[model samples]
Target: MTDIHPTAIVETGAAIGENVRVGPYSTVGPNVRLADNVVLESHVVVAGHTEVGAGTHIFPFASIGHKPQDLKYAGEETRLLIGKNNQIREHVTMNPGTSGGGGLTRVGDNGLFMMGSHVGHDCKVGNFAILANNATLAGHVELADHVILGGLSAVRQWTRIGTGAIVGGMTGVEFDVIPFGSVIGDRARLAGLNLIGLKRKEFPREQIHALRAAYRDLFDTEDGTLRARAEAVAETAADQPLVKMVTDFILEKDDRRFCTPRSGE
Candidate 1:
């Protein structure tokens, strides 16, 4: 019982699953596949070899699965794979992958892409993330679970944002943001833990306390490299899971500089 408006265009060979609705003037391309209970509001265009998962709702003027904006893209076959229960709002653009980027762009489940947000080619955005209005992710960026990009924030190409990080409004992130870090300023710097989010998600209070102490020890000290300080904390707070996660992320094989707290804070 898929209900598609007469004015909408479902190209031949497109796959629309049960209980889906394609609204007025929307277009589903030949290579598009909409899973069960998907809803495309008016004027949405889903193109390319895209597979939108079940229970996703896309609003008007969303341009999904378009060709990558990369100048290096020479029209090779690429794909955008979106997971379940995402809310993609008006004027959001999610481009397909490019050959140079391994030919796939992946979005995990339960994301909220607000108005005018753009996910660049080859980005891997993780589950439970929120990209606020006008937030932009450059090509090949990887966002770990529960990351939140505030309005007008942007990340440079190839940067990896760790789990539970928050990039504040108008910030430009040029480095890797640590998990649970709150970053701000035009050129981003880590401010502190995202305490609100961590509390809302019900992270263990004792572990949060340990992470705060470790944050002060790791970043506040001028004595050691970040990895070295994190290693020390890992040894001391080794029983704390959050501390271990922070240390592991610090020691992981990442190319970008780790975001550090401002000198005073």
Candidate 2:
């Protein structure tokens, strides 16, 4: 029961499931597999060794599964794996991985890629994440579950954005962003805990309070020794979920760099 526009080109080797729709002038290349209920709007292009899960909708002019733009790609076999129920808006471009970086770019279920967004090679995007309009993630970036990248925000290569973190509009993130924290500005200062986001996600009030206190102790001091403060806070606030999130984020090392509080602490 799939519908394919006359002008659209689907390679014979492609595997398209039931109820899928391919709009005008779209193209599905060989080795591409789209599960049931997926929709590819006008001018969409899905190529390479890519697989789109069920119920994913890719809007007009979105180019997915394209070879990595990295110079080191050298025509190696790479893959782009997108999970179910994702909404990839117009003009968004997602590149597959490079052999130099594990040969895979993966996106989890229920993610939203707003218009003009670009996800570079080797990135791993988590479930329910939101990439606002024009947001750009460079190569090797990892975005955890429920993280929000505001409009026009740009994250540098190899940076890890923790779960539930929020990067405000126009921010430039060069380092790892702590879980549940709000970051803003060019160098990305730690504004505070993402209380509004946590509240919206229905996190309890007591957990929010503990996180706020932990944030204060971790970032408010002149010494700004986040590790020690985080350890102490973790020992005292162990029972709080929010506290555990903060402590784990501080302790986890991404690409050998810990999340550092903004300078001038």
Candidate 3:
């Protein structure tokens, strides 16, 4: 018993589950699958080989499952898979994967994509993440669980945002963001531990304290050798969750160096 607006155009080959609502002037293309309780607001377009999970709501003028805007993209069979209970706000554009990038763009459950946000080709967004208004993630980016991108922030291609990290507004991030840390500004320097976010997530006090200590040790250094700092923190603070997060961040760094502390601190 789906409720489809008369102005909406749903192709016969599209698979729509029960209790779905298609608003006026929306379009659903062939090979698109809308699961139970999904709602597409007016002027929304669900195209290509896209699959919308149950209980997901897409707001007005949002575009999902469009082909990659990459120049390297050929006419390959890419797919976009969105999980359940996601709220995609107005004017958001989520693009599918490119043939060069394995052809899959995936988003996990309970995520919030705010108005005017853009997710580029082959991006993998984890559960419970929040992309604030005008937040943009480039191709091949990965957002771990509970990451928060503030308004007007843009992440460069292939960058990874670690779990529980908070990216400040108007920042341009070109490197990986450490887990449980806060980043701000164009060069995206590490501000401090995301204490407020940790508290909201119900992280233990001991863990938070240990993370604060680790942050001090890492950033308070003269030369800021993250490897040396991480090793030192691991030896003493290994039992703490925050210490483990810092250790993992140091180990996972590929080519770029971690954000260093400001001088005279």
Candidate 4:
């Protein structure tokens, strides 16, 4: 029960699963694989070695599985893996990986990539994430589950955004963001916890309070280095998983700095 418009081009080697639809002027490349119930709207181009999971819907003008924009890429075989139930909106451009970046870019289930959002080469995007209009991830960025990038935001290469974190509109995020963190500013800085998201998720009030306290101790106090403060908080909030999420993220080995509250804020 697959429907492909007469004007659409499905290459000979393309794999189309059950109940799939390819709209007018769209092109499915030879190496592309569309799973069951996938829909590609008019004028979409799915190329390279890309795989779209079942139940995903791609809107018009989306350029999926394009070659990596990296100059280092020398026409090597790479792949873009998009998970199930994702909504990829118009003008979204997602590129595959490069040989330098392990040759794979992965997106997890239930993501919403709004218009003009770009997923760069080798990026790892987790489940339930949303990238607002014009939001962009540079190469090798990693977004943990439930992360949200507001409109016009851009993340620097190699930065990792922890689970449940949200980056506000128009921000340029150069540093890692801790789990459940809210960050905003032209140049990003940690604002606070994502209280609204936590409440929506029904996180326990006690756990939220403990996480808040631990966040204060970790960031507000200027008595020690971030790592030392995170270690202390880890010891004190050892039993609180929510608090531990932040501490563990801070303690994890990485060369990049993380977003922190503004001085004297």
Which candidate achieves the best lDDT against the true structure?
4
Give Cα-based local distance difference scores for all models: 0.94, 0.90, 0.89, 0.96
Candidate 2 structure quality by residue, lDDT tens digits, 1-265 = 9999999999999999999999999999999999999999999999999999999999999999988889878999899999999999999999999987899999999999999999999999999989999999999999999999999999999998889999999989988888988888877878877888899999878878888887777777856456777788889888988788878877775234544566665
lDDT tens per residue, model 3, 60-175: 99999988889998789999999999999999999999887779999999999999999999999999989999999999999999999999999999888888999999988887
Residues 150-186, candidate 4, lDDT per residue (tens digit)? 9999999999999999999999999999999999999
Query: Which candidate's TM-score is highest?
Result: 4
**What are the models' TM-scores?**
0.97, 0.95, 0.95, 0.99
Clashing residue pairs in candidate 3, if any? none
What residue runs in model 1 are displaced by over 4 Å at the alpha carbon? none
Candidate 2 Cα lDDT to native? 0.90
Clashes of each: 0, 0, 0, 0
Listed per candidate, the RMSD to the true structure in angstroms reads 1.0, 1.7, 1.5, 0.7
The local lDDT score (0 to 100) that residue 74 gets in candidate 2 is: 93
